[model samples]
Target: MRFVQVAQHADDLKRAAAFYAALFDVEPAALFDPPGLLFFDVGGVRLLLEKGAPSSLLYFEVADLHGTVAALRSRGVKIVQDPQLIYTHDDNTLGPSNSEEWMAFIEDSESNTVGLVSHTLAAGD
Candidate 1:
């Protein structure tokens, strides 16, 4: 099975759409005028934007979580959670023992909790 579409709710269609456009670096694939739904193609996955508050968090994979968060911060994106180690591996996953997983979060214009994450095989302090 494959996941084709995921949705997020936003009270302000224009603001949310702008934010997503800036984030994805592309205009929405389709826009519905009446209910004000905007859809963006995210690496083959369809991200549907609708009206209301987001029901859950959306985590976007990033090559550099810290750098991405910093860049987004400079662009006026609200960072709810700073970059930090969210998990660590004891076995050899990325490197030897002590490999870490990092994550950070930002609140979207539509009050959605969006996250950025990175996983590497390097040992962390």
Candidate 2:
């Protein structure tokens, strides 16, 4: 089954909305004016943010983690962890050994951490 929605908590909705709008460059599909909440359509998934302590970190998959990282870096997004192999499925995986299961992380405006994941093998892998 496909994931339809994911949520992230934000103590300040206005700030959260601004941070996400710039990062995604997309207007939220749904929003609440006060006590705020915002939702951005990430592909088909609705990324929801509510007023509260930050929720668990979300990991978004990317075709090219390195390229994605570079773009985010240019936008001044803080890289929490450089992309590396987070796992390797021996029998079943989309890529060759050594480079499968790659990931990287960055911090958002609300100090919420988000990650980028990929299945492609890196150069040296």
Candidate 3:
């Protein structure tokens, strides 16, 4: 099955929209003014933000680790964890191998945990 959309509750739609726009470096494709629902295109995935209960965590895979982190920081988004390297071992040889993946967590005004991830593994790796 293919993934379609993920939704997060926002306390303030405008503020949350701005936060996400800055974090992802793209504006929302649509916004429902009366209902306070905003939609953003994240690569091939769709993210929907509306006024409701806050979410615990939402993970997003991004292309540019440094640029995404910088944008989030500039917008005053709280960083729960900074980007760091993680080591993985080869399954067959048990040899040490390194992969560059970065993770960061942030809470919106409504206390939704937004996680940013950058996976460095190749298609077949």
Candidate 4:
């Protein structure tokens, strides 16, 4: 079955909401306080930010890894690891053939490590 929702810890909902909104470039789909829950529709998956949920390391695919990292850095977002080529997809098993997979890590507002990924055409491809 496909993922319906993913939960992430957020001590302060407002702070987390603002951070996520900037990163995702979209407003949250829903918020339910009192019980303290906020949700964002991430590619049809519900990203639930909750007060009691444990922190999760989430990975998101972006069209431009470097550009996204730069924009985030300019906004004082902590870059845990700079973007770098992670792997070359020689075959179509994990990704498109003759493509390069790049990845970078950053710290979310709540201090959870988040991974950003991108795939680009390999040299001479």
- lDDT (Cα atoms) of all candidates against the true structure: 0.83, 0.81, 0.73, 0.96
C-alpha lDDT of residue 104 in model 4 = 99
Question: Model 3, residue 87: displacement in angstroms?
Answer: 5.2
Those runs of model 2 whose alpha carbons end farther than 4 Å from true positions after fitting are: 93-99, 121-125
Tell me the deviation in Å of residue 40 in model 3: 0.6
Worst 10 residues of 1 by lDDT: 91-100
What is residue 116's positional error in candidate 3, in angstroms?
A: 1.3
lDDT digits (tens) for residues 27-114 of candidate 3 = 8989988877789998777888887645747877777766777877787777677776543444424222434456777677667777
Candidate 4 residue-wise lDDT, 14-49, digit = tens: 999999999999999999988899999999999999
**Best candidate per lDDT, number?**
4
Q: Flag the better candidate by lDDT, 2 or 3.
A: 2
- Positional deviation of 64 in candidate 2, in angstroms? 1.5
What is the Cα-based lDDT of residue 119 in candidate 2? 84
Q: Model 1, residue 57: displacement in angstroms?
A: 0.8
Candidate 2 has its poorest 10 consecutive residues by lDDT at 89-98
By lDDT rank, best first, the candidates go 4, 1, 2, 3
Predicted structure with the largest TM-score when compared to the true one: 4
Candidate 4 wrong stretches, greater than 4 Å? none
- Give the TM-score of each candidate: 0.84, 0.77, 0.73, 0.97
- Model 1 clash pairs are 94-121
Tens digit of per-residue lDDT, candidate 1, span 41-114: 98899998888535668888878888888889999999999999877878776534666778898999887899
